[model samples]
Target: MEAVQFSPPLGYVFDPTDCELVGFYLCNKIANKPVPGIDYSIPQYDLYGSEEPWQIWNFFKQRLGEERDDQDLYFFTQLKKKTSKGSRIDCSVGTGTWQGEDGGREIVNDNMRVGTKKRFRYENKDSDQHGGWIMHEYSLDQHSDYVVCRIRKSEPALKKNKRGKCQEVDSEKKKKRSKVQEVDSEPLPLAVPPATSRTAPTTTMVQQQIQLEDETRGF
Candidate 1:
């Protein structure tokens, strides 16, 4: 029998609500305060650099060893003006550009507007092809120059049946147990009937039946 190989657990998930992103992360970042789990969760990066969207994706995907294609990436990026004298911000990549889809959306926390989030789509420089990549740029209301951005592939390259983290863990455990059972060569021991026993059920049998009934009720 072959030993089953188990993969490592799917690490922390970085999903945060819009309010949390603005009130906690964006605010802390602007204030130069320590943000918990920022290094592993949302790292600082040059989002508007020369690298294309796909190139950035491959780099991080390899570095992080993330198997899921549907996960979103969060980053702290500084916005740069188009020119030294111009007030417009540049959103161009190497050969692609991030075209804004909307003006801006207010991100409110505790009935107070904390920041603005705007959506962008990556488009090729010389072609009409677009929408393979998406980004949500978040900036503080007071400090709009520097912002936090969330990037994600609009459509996943690899598509599979959706499963939760708990489901994946349970599946791995079941596979390990099955492999162990197969490797064990010990013979089963036969159970002997009690002396002078009739058709009456044992206390253990009643307890197991009751437990099964309780489990069935859950469904």
Candidate 2:
């Protein structure tokens, strides 16, 4: 199967929310059911390799046009179980490691907590200058086998900066949150969208029920 590029291809926009990632796509992958664009949208990879972030971005990024996802790159990565146990994420990838920020938070799908998506910052020995890059790691509550990471270069607001810069970032964040909430609260549909399009999340029972429905729908 041809893999989906990280960036949107011609005549299409690939914009998915936290809810859709955890509720729909991640759920299907955990259940071993077929995700329509799994092979393309999110290819399997262990991103903790030696390759630099930009280098990795180039590998999965869209080469069709000037359009690109400089801030976020999606990949289906397996969670490495430590011999010590207890969900200890093996963070070492190359010369840097991704450090989790602000503990994990729950993401609800149709009023039910489907999973927790955590935010992590990249860091290295030389300097903590890697703050420009961020990783949003999503893993189902029950299924911890594999995760989908939305890696992007996000520069935090500087303390010395004025209110304008903060406002801009806040606006973008508000729009993102609004979009995610809007998509998650909607009801499930019988028909699925096309592969080129990034589908939205729908209201459902628990993840298992949603999984069954997805299987029946062949989405």
Candidate 3:
């Protein structure tokens, strides 16, 4: 018989170092919230480090078309660490310039502490553009072992519709109005009177009185 060769293991073990960062931008409304900041940092590692940075940057440049000095983009990342029991994770945010090498530059910041939140401001080097800081507040118990990051372009002030003033529509009013209209449109049925409305027939006392008068006349 031939001796059989044995293999130690078939698959690779999980490595913390092998893990990659991923991130996304929060919606304009929620961008200031804590979750977005934590979530936005992950993609930076995946986007910038996974592939050649320059190649990705070149591709981004072509897609973007024109480049400007005043624009900014933000993202977040989650850091995974190996532990005896399991993996531990933390969240962070990456924000900075966009366009050239300097444009790709980013700043990674710690996420808001549980029960406490913070906001960041962006300053434009150029004075001609309208630049302002965004405010973010962290929700309670929002932090976790996993991190979530969000990115968004600075938005202009929102304009309200000029045609109508905001008014709340109530279902109760609609229902009541419909009931009133139905009552007004339809005619009511005739009502019948009760038997009590007529006078009681001549009482038994009157009949007795007539019989007594006849008896007295015969006498």
Candidate 4:
């Protein structure tokens, strides 16, 4: 099978952690033969040149139950670009995150809401200074006519409670049931029947006298 190749969008901003374009390069296997320069500049290439790009795009979109639009194309292009640079990327669509100050919204603190407005920012872990901030607004809810970029939160660190313990609580009924079972398993005292006295019955004297009279009459 011919290997798949992805090309990045022109002049795309690179992000290490949250960028989507980077993911495509890592996933798709590149062809061994050099791609002609003309192919690179084209808006779309034959995923399997035998098939149309829209057809392949539609196939994926159908499987994902997503609309295949310009945003999706742009997203794929960006992914291709990111991969070319030796950065890592994911194959699946995901919630994207924008870090740093540039292309980011102003930090808003209100009674109900407080946080930086949704914006793309750059952060460098290696640098001594915190990365520069840029502000830009994005329509996360809207599907992009060009390329849709979705932001998502990264994994958060597990935090310990005040007592440095994180324990899951069981229902009260379960605790009671366990206690009952434990008590039932232990040995218990055996019950004994109470003792009772018996009395003997006496024979009637009239019956004995009658028997003696009958014997005397026979004599």
Best by lDDT: 1
For the record, the alpha-carbon RMSD of candidate 2 to the native fold, in angstroms, is 36.6
Q: Candidate 1 lDDT, tens digit per residue, 1-219?
A: 112222323776789988888778988988999966676577777888898787777777666678787888887889989899999999987588898999999998778888899999887734323557889999888998988888898663212212333577799999999999887966788999768657885668889999999999999
Q: Lowest lDDT 10-mer window, candidate 2?
A: 155-164
Off by over 4 Å in 4: 1-13, 16-137, 140-147, 150-153, 157-166, 169-181, 184-187, 194-219
What is the Cα-based lDDT of residue 72 in candidate 2? 55
Quantify how close model 3 is to the true structure by its C-alpha RMSD in Å. Answer: 23.1
Q: Per-residue alpha-carbon lDDT of model 3 for 1-219, expressed as tens digits?
A: 112222213242211110122222222223453433232222232321233323333343343331531332222333344554775421211232222112111223344223323333333334211123232222223333223222222334111211111222355677889999999999788898765536766558889899999999999
What is candidate 2's lDDT per residue for 1-219, written digit by digit as tens? 234454444565446899999888888887889976566566777877777665566566644243444535677888775556576768766578888897889998789998998888777645433554678899988887778998776545222233555687899999999999999999998897666535866545797687888899985
TM-score of each: 0.64, 0.61, 0.25, 0.23
lDDT of all predictions: 0.78, 0.71, 0.33, 0.34
**TM-score order of candidates, top first:** 1, 2, 3, 4
Q: Any idea what lDDT model 2 has?
A: 0.71
Q: Which is the better candidate, 3 or 4, if ranked by lDDT? A: 4
Clashing pairs in 2: 3-40, 4-40, 48-93, 71-152
Question: How well does candidate 1 score on lDDT at residue 154?
Answer: 63
Model 1 vs. true fold: TM:
0.64
Sequence-dependent TM-score of model 3: 0.25
- Per model, state how many residue pairs clash: 0, 4, 25, 27
For model 3, state the Cα shift of residue 109 in Å: 25
Model 4 quality (TM-score): 0.23
